[model samples]
Target chain A: MTALARALITLAVPVLLVLLAVLAVPADGPTCLGIGLRIWALFACAPATSAWLWWRQRAVPA
Target chain B: MIAAFVAVMALSLLIALWARRGAGQGPRAFFVAGGQLGAILFFFLSVGETYSIATMLGFPGGVYAGGEGFVVWFFGYILLAAPVLAVLGPWIWRAGNLYGAVTIPDFFAAHFNSRLLERVIALGAIALLVPIGTMQFAGIRLVLGALAPGLPMPLLLAGAGLVVMAYVALAGLRAAAFVAVLKDALMLGAILLVGALALLHWPIATTPVATATMAAQVPVTLPFALSTIAVQALGFAMIPQNWAFLFAARGPQAIVRAQAAAPLYMVMFPLLMAVAVFARRMGLPVDKPDFVFLAAAQHLLPGWALGVVMAAVVLAGMVILSSVCLAIAPLLTRNVLPGLDGRAQQRWAQGVTALFIALSAAGAMAQVPLLAMLNTVFYFGIVQTLPGFLAALWTGRVRAGGVLAGMAVAALAIIGVRLAGISAGGINPGLIGLILNSVVLTLVTLMFPRRDGHSVMAMLR
Candidate 1:
């Protein structure tokens, strides 16, 4: 991956995770299923981001 | 419960003996565990740190006592510090592999070419690590006191102390690693089972009510809760002791995978958050906020299940922390002290580690709040190193003088401010030191003439 691409992806992954966490926990509220869903979302991002990064980096010389 | 305690300690002793049988003797055996950890063991070891009694107890209490602000900082700032490891761990491993440096202070000496700096860092780390060591003693006693409240506190602490010292002295980091696997598993299983059962008695919808009821019960806002997650995340991945395990990772790729896999540990936080929230919603008295995890399990689950969960939480507290302190004290002794040959140094390292633990245990028994004291020291000491280490890797021109100078200034500021009882708002004073350290490093590097790359690398050694 190009330098810019790697940097952006690296930055975005954490930001996305943090944003999802904020949205997951209720604001002035409690949501049981929402909490579970938010955690699931956080977990899903890891494999998804890893795959995307891996596939993108494949074009570079190994 | 007593039987369960005996079983866990017996199993730990057996593992310690097994690990020692093939393990090399002295500091190499004690400090790095022969530096042969693979991805699987490394993963558990790293995650076991994430599952400290602080997280199991202190974090949820923050969420319970404070409101959403604690939640945001708790979970959010963790992501702030992880990218640091992505860069720092690889270089540390490579350098350690090249130089055969087993401890962070050794790495400091190698990187800065200064024995004095290495000693300072080691001293800072030991002072910082005292809180963690104290917490371990307190955590084990808390567990013992609960399981058998009739047992005298000193006797309970002594019993746990004997177990911790025995395993650490006999087996070293391998014992900690072996126990980490069981600790994390026990923690995971117990929290999940208890969380699920807690939901049965106290619906998730009523969590806020529970939280509100418990809030009125606290004497003050939890002292260290607000910035803990950030402080923890930043320092957690960076501590010379824990990060030494990064050196033991099989290679750069294993380090990357461990870094990548680290976020998964974040999922457990919410489970802990749920328990604290549910317990509060149920109007449970969290007089000792540290006991919230155990209290939740006892209140929510069946007798047998509670027994199992309590044993797990207590064991997790004892084994994982003992492992960390075991490595930390020895690392301090070996790297900080100068003019010693390898063989002699190794023996001295073991002696120092034992002394460090003994002092820490004594402090905890004197009624110092272990969790708070440990966090304050750890956050201050480890965060200062972040800039020096990070700049050395990512920025080629970062002078050794600049890094050293920044660390000195930052250390002074933090110590000075702390002695004055002035905090830097919610952010840790250590982090403030880190900022100064980074700025000085960047500015100094930009201003100064670049040294020859070969000489710089040589100086780094």
Candidate 2:
């Protein structure tokens, strides 16, 4: 993918995760459950971010 | 337990000194660790700022004392800000590298070619950092007091401050980064262990497991949560120490790789919440709300493990305090006192680091009302520099005069809002100040665009 394409994916990744979070995690759930879901969501978002960054690193090599 | 705590503290100092063995010489070497930190050191250092004593104790304590709502903004800010850093951090590295900048003031002054603006940022940064350095001591007092109830709080804090000063004096940023690797490992282990224990021994709950994250009586209102997250997430990008850490990176890619992993580190938060709930469930005597995490861990862990946990907490505070001292040292010697050569700068750095520690310790000991208020506004005030920094990085259209004027109006706006005693319904006042600052800055720049014909973006490219 092009750099612009990768940038767009990086931008889009958060929105998609938010959408999935809304579907998977209940906002008004139990505190522990809510915390768990958020962590789960974070797990989802964080690794995805790393993958995106790793891909972007190739285009702009060190 | 006492032996364990002492050993951990010694290890932290040893790692810091170890970082300086065979290290390059001169002010830059000391300040930015010779600007050759690989991805691992940069990752540890950058993430170090996120998991401070505040996270270890304050996160759980806030939840145990207040409600789970406390985690919303705290976790939100950390989780959301990673991407922002991942995007902006490399760019910040680019800016810092373009001008060989060690401090934010150094970057601003070099980019704008304005000594007066440098002074403004340097003074503002020092004022902003005052509360932050002291807050670490506040945590130190709380953690050490819990561990060794026999030890005097004042003496413990003073000693912790001295040790942090020693770290700065020893290797500057490299010392902080090297020690950060140990602090992070121990902190993460402690949190995960205590949290897991809390889960394994989950008590029958009087209340439901699904306690609401945003309770009606909770102080962390929805507007406040959303607004604080937004403002702080952006402001997190603008923090001075983070900049210093990023500048230590070998290049922009190191920043990219390091910050990319920062968000994943927040995996510790859920466990933090678990530990908080554990404290509440067992009806632990949380006389001081901030001690809830330590109280729970003390209840769960055996002597040696407790020692390791306490050491982690203390070292968490020390690493951050050392980073703040590092940030301030350069501001004082390099930007604030620009005439010092390498030898003179290092000499002044030691004295300045010691003086800063002394003053911060004095203020923390006194608990002056004004210092407390400054703590409240530090984040808001710190971000006021963001506009000017962005202008310097992305365009030459911005003038030092414009940046200065915007920051002045923003500071006054925040002061006014505070004096009026308005919460804006839990919204952060600094966000308001930042908006007004941006508008004023835009108008001033438009009305009087620069004729210097220098393009910062072009130069960087």
The best candidate in terms of TM-score: 2
Model 2 pairs whose backbones collide: A30-B210, A31-B211
Q: For candidate 2, what is the lDDT?
A: 0.77
The most accurate candidate by lDDT is 2
**CAPRI tier of model 1:** acceptable
Model 1 misplaced stretches (Cα beyond 4 Å): A1-12, A19-26, A33-62, B21-26, B77-83, B203-213, B216-231, B302-304, B341-347, B369-374, B394-399, B416-426, B446-461
In model 2, where do residues sit more than 4 Å from their true spots?
Answer: A1-26, A30-58, B207-218, B341-344, B367-376
lDDT at residue B216 of model 1 (Cα atoms) = 26
Q: Is the docking of candidate 2 incorrect, acceptable, medium or high quality?
A: acceptable
lDDT of 2 by residue, B1-461 (tens): 98999999998888888988867887678778888888888898888866888888777777776643456666666766776677777778888888888888888888778899999999888888878877777777777777778977778887898789878878888999899999999998998889888888778764433243323224666566667666777788878888888888888777777767776677777778778777777777666667878888888989889899999998998888888888888898888888888778778877877777777777767765543346547778888988887667556888888999999999998898889988887778888888888899899999998877355557855
| Model 1 complex DockQ against the native | 0.26
Q: Per-residue lDDT for B76 in model 2?
A: 66
Worst 10 residues of 1 chain B by lDDT: B216-225
Instruction: Give the per-residue lDDT of model 1 (tens digit) for B1-461.
Output: 56665676677678767767666666665667777777787777655656777567666776666555555555554544454455445566776776677777776677666687777777777777777777766766666677888878778776666777777777777777777777787788877787777666665444344434345222322233334544556676667666667766677666666666665555666678778867776667666666777788777766666666666666676676566666566555566666688767667766776676677678777868435545567677777777766565454566667777888888888788779888555456766677777787777878883464333234344
